[model samples]
Target: MSEFGNLVDSIEIPLRWGDQDAYGHANNTVYFRFFEEARITWLDSVPMKTAPKGTGPIIIKTSATFLKELNYPATVQVRTYAGKAGNTSLESWYEIFDSKTGVKYAEGYAKIVWFDHETRKSTRLPDELRALAAE
Candidate 1:
């Protein structure tokens, strides 16, 4: 798998037949879902009550690079790494690999900002969540 930094979490996602496109490879958009799953899994590790009532992490930007085509009847392991953290935003990186063969399929990163649902503005990340991201 491509290394971005120290891995913080990982999850196995099974490929569904519906994930494939007319071209017979996994749809490009599916990679983003895999990354989302990994990111959510990592974030869920933090205490739910850490954030203020109306504040939570929201994706501000995301990007991915496909290295290989993913086919059906396979399983992928998505690994997440913690990146730089700021007062109101944090970075998360992802590496997707074939679970059995260990071949990397894609790599990506996302910038997530802490947001206040009520105010619709950026907010500071909770101390607990920030500590987890720093790890």
Candidate 2:
């Protein structure tokens, strides 16, 4: 358990040269990608059953707040945490830090909704996913 909630997962991603912009720092959008990677990794690790058409965990909303500029030649660790759960969605949080220095660089949030592809509508959050909420 951590401040954000139950520690779901963490991953280290090496910053690529293309990730940086003309300012020599990572673009804001890149942080969102880092968050997405960590979040998807966590979901994949969960041994949950597949729904119809395997449609699941669609991100309804996502946000990232930059605390510090990210530069290349560095490895960033993105930590994912479980947050609150709703009827058809769950909230997840993220923290990005320098792997070597442990200096936090960004924070993020994402709301994932369980959806049925055939129905093309939101569905009830699975018990396994709902259980991921902080208790």
Give Cα-based local distance difference scores for all models.
Answer: 0.87, 0.90
- Count of clashes, each model: 0, 0
The number of the candidate with the highest TM-score is 2
Worst 10 residues of 2 by lDDT: 48-57
lDDT (Cα) of model 2: 0.90
Q: What is candidate 1's CA lDDT for residue 18? A: 99
Collision count of model 2? 0
For candidate 1, write residues 44-126 as lDDT tens digits: 88666754457888998999999999999899999998777798988889999999999999999999898999899998877
Across residues 1-135, which tens digit of lDDT does each residue of candidate 2 receive?
Answer: 887788878899999999999999999999999998898889998889886476687998988889999998899999999998889989899999999999999999998898988888999998988888987
Which parts of model 2 are misplaced by more than 4 Å?
A: none
Q: Which residue pairs collide in model 1, if any? A: none
Supply candidate 1's per-residue lDDT for 108.
93
Q: Which stretches of candidate 1 lie over 4 Å from their true place?
A: 1-3
Total clashes in model 1, counting residue pairs 3 or more apart in sequence or in different chains: 0
